[model samples]
Target: MIMQSLRGRLFLGLTAVIVLAGGLGGLLTYQWAFDEAIEMQDSVLIQIGSVLQHGAQSAPAETPLAGVDSDAEVVIRELGTAPRGAVADRQLWGFADGLRTDSLQGRPVRLLLRSRPDGSRFAVAQQTAIRNEIAGELAFRALVPIAALIPCLMLVTALVINRSFQPVKRLAAKLNARQADDLDKLPVENAPRELHPFIASINGLLERIRLMVDQQRRFIADAAHELRTPITALSLQAENLEQLLLSDDGRARLASLRTGMSRTKHLLEQLLALARYEMGRPGKSPLVSLDQVAKDVVAELLPEAVERGVDLGFEIIEPSWVRAELVALAAMIRNLLDNALRFTPRGGHIDLGIYRQGEAAVLQIEDSGPGIAPADMARIFEPFYRGGRPSGDGSGLGLSIVKRIVENLGGTIAIENIQGAGLSGLRVTVELHHECDARATGRQQAPAAVPAES
Candidate 1:
C-alpha cells in the first residue's frame, strides 16, 4: 500500500495507541464492576444469615411465629432439626437453590429463623427491595466516573502527540517554501537532532553546486572577452583585403589577413583545451613520469630555442614516478614551457627541473626573461588576462590552462620572480602527490611520451 504523509502516519499511530488503551481500560473497569457486584451480593447474604440467627435466639418461646411465608417456613423447619444450643451450619447448599431461584425470578427475599425442641422451625421473611436498589445505584455510580474520563484521556493524548510533532511539521514547511537557488545553510536551531546530519550534507552539496555555477559563468564571460578582439581583427582584416584590389596592395593585405586568422584559430583552440581540462574524464589515472614529460616538452621547443640562440636545459632532481593522464600532463608542461619561450628574450636561458620534495613530486620551470611585476603576479594565472598588453602573439590562457591541469591532478602550481640568481625571469613550480615504493614498482616500466608536432 502507498504510505501516508508524516502527519497522517503519526496521527494513525497515536490513535491506535489511544484506542488500545481505551479498550484495555474499559475491560478493566468492567471486570472491577463485576467483582464489586459479586462481593456486595455475598455480604448481603451473610448479613441476612446473621440476622436470622439472632432472631431465632431472641423470638418469644410460647407464641407461634405467625405470618411466616412458605419459603421462610421451610428454612425454619430445617433449622429445627439442629440441636438448640449448637452452632448453625454455615454451609449455603441447603438454601442456595432457593436463593438462586428467587434471584432469577426477581423476587428478592431475606429470612430470620430458629429450630424448636420438637423439630419444628419458626421464621420471619421480608422482601429485600433495598438490596437490589443499592446494587443498581452502585453500578451506575461506578460507571459514571469512568465513562466521563475516556474522552478526556483521548483529548490529552492527542494534544501531547501533536505538540511532539510540531518541529517536524515546521521543518517540512520551511523546506517546501525554499527556492531552487536558495543554497544557504539551513537554520537548524530547535530542529530535531536526528535530521541535523542530513541537512548538513544537503547544504554541503548545494554549496558545491553554487561554486561550480559561479565558475562556469566566469569562464563564459572571460572566453567571450578573449575571443572578441581576435574576431574583430579578423573581420577588419578581411574588409581591408576586399578593398586592397583598388589600392594595388592585395598581397600585403592577404598576409595580414592570414596572420589574423591564425591568431583567431589559436585563441579558439586554447578556449577548447581549457574547457576540456575543466571537464575532466572519469577513470583511473595512467602511470606517467615527471622526467619523461619534462624531456618531451624540452625536445618539442628545442628548434625555437636554437633559432633564438637561447639555452634550454632539463635536469632530473629525483628519480621518482607519478600517476597521471599522459596527454593532460604533456599539455600542462607544454603550456608552461610555451609561455616561457614566448616571453623570454632571444639568447636567454630556460631551465626545467623535476624532483621529489617530501611526499610530493615537483616540477620547476625557470626562464631568464623580464620578470613579472609584483602587482601583476596574482592576475597572471587568470584566463585571458594578459599583463599590460604585451605582444599579442600569445593567447593569455597558457598559465590558466597550466593551473587547471595541475589542479586536476590533485597538485598545486605557483609562480614567483627569481631574485639574485643571475636570472630575472619568472619561476613556476608544480607539485603532485607521488606514489610510494609498492605502487611505483608495479608501474616501473616507463611509457614513451607522444612526440609533439613540429
Candidate 2:
C-alpha cells in the first residue's frame, strides 16, 4: 500500500515524527514546570513559618494569623514548652526547627516548625496532596497550548503538501486532455524546479515518438502512391488480354487474376486513404450540414446497394449542423456507409439517421448483417483487424479511417450489437457538437421521412 501512493507515505511519516517530537517535548516541559512549582511552594511555607516565629509572642496562643487562615490550608498550632499536644504535634516537636514531611491526622502534610523567644513552638503546615495538585495544575496548563498547536501544525502541514502537489495534478490533466496526434512538448514554466527535469524528459520522449510516427506514415503513403501506377497498368494489360481468343480454362484463370488484382487495388486505395487522414490535419472547423453529408454519401453508394439487392435509404434526416471540416465529414459518413453496405447480406436493409439531440448532432447507421463477436468488439476499430468471421471484400481499414476522422472532428463513435426477437445486427452511432442556427429557434425541426431506394 505504501508503494501505491507517495502522498500517503509522506503524510503518515511526517505525522509520526511530529507526534514523537511533540510528546517528548511536552514530557520535558511538564517535568520542569512541576519541579519549579514544588520549589516555589516550599519557599512560601518557609516564609510563613518565619513570620509566625517572630509574631507568635504578641499573638494569642494557638491562634491563626490574620492574613493566613484555615481556608488556605495553613495550620498554625502552638505546642507547650514540653510538647503536650496530639501525637502528630508531639512528633513535630521531636524534630529540630526545620521543614519535614509527616502525617497529620493520618493525612500527609509538609510542616515548617520554629520556636519563639519564650521557648513556645508553632508549626505552619499545608497538605501534601494540595501542594502536588497546584503544581500539577500549573504543569498541565503549560501542556494545553502545546496540545492545541500540534493539531494546527498538522493541518498546516497537510495544506502545504496538497498545495505543493497541485502542479503535478495540473500536468496530468493537460496530458489527458490532449488529442491522439498531439505530441507537443510539456511546458515547464511556473512548475517546481524539482519537476523541471522530469518534464523535460517527457518532452524529449514525445518528440522522438512524433518523429517515428511521421516516418511510418510517410513510408506508407509513399509506398502506396508508387505502387498504384504499376497496379493500374497491370489491370489495363489484363483488360487488353481479355480481347484475345482463348480456351475456356484460360478465360476462367483470367477472371480469377482480375479478382485478385481488384482486391489488391482496393487494399492499396485503403492504405492511401488511411495515411492521408492520419498525416493531414483538418485545418479549420466550418459549420457543415450533417444531414446533407449523409445524404450525399448514401446517393453515391446507392448503386452498389441496388446491385447487391440491399435496401438503403435514410430513415431520419433533420437539418442538423456540426462544426467540422467538410472533407472530414464526408469521409466519415462515406466510410460508415461503405462498411454497412459491404457487411449487409443480399435482400437485407441498411438504415441511416441524422438528427440533433440536445446539444449534439447524431448520425446513426444500422445494417441487417452478422453482428460482431464479443471477443472482436474490443479490437473492431483497430487497423487491419478483420475478425474471425471476416466476410466480403473488406480491406479492414474502413472503420479505422472513420474513427480517425471522427476523432479529428472532435466527435465520438459507438458500436453495439443489436439484439432482439428474431433479429441480430450492428448499430453504429456518432455524435458531434451541434452548431445551432442563429436564424431559427432553439428547437430542431422534426425528422424528414425518406423512402428506401429500390
The number of the candidate with the highest lDDT is 2
Residue 132 alpha-carbon offset, candidate 1, angstroms: 63
Model 2 misplacement above 4 A: 1-20, 50-197, 280-282, 438-454
lDDT by residue (319-393, candidate 2, tens digit) is 888776666677788788877777888999999988889989999999999889989999998999988788768
lDDT string for model 1 (299-396, tens) is 77899889887888975556657777777788888888887887788888888888889999999999998878888887988888888736668888
Specify the highest-TM-score model's number: 2
Q: Candidate 1: deviation at residue 420, Å?
A: 1.6
Q: Pick out the ten consecutive residues of candidate 1 with the lowest summed lDDT.
A: 68-77
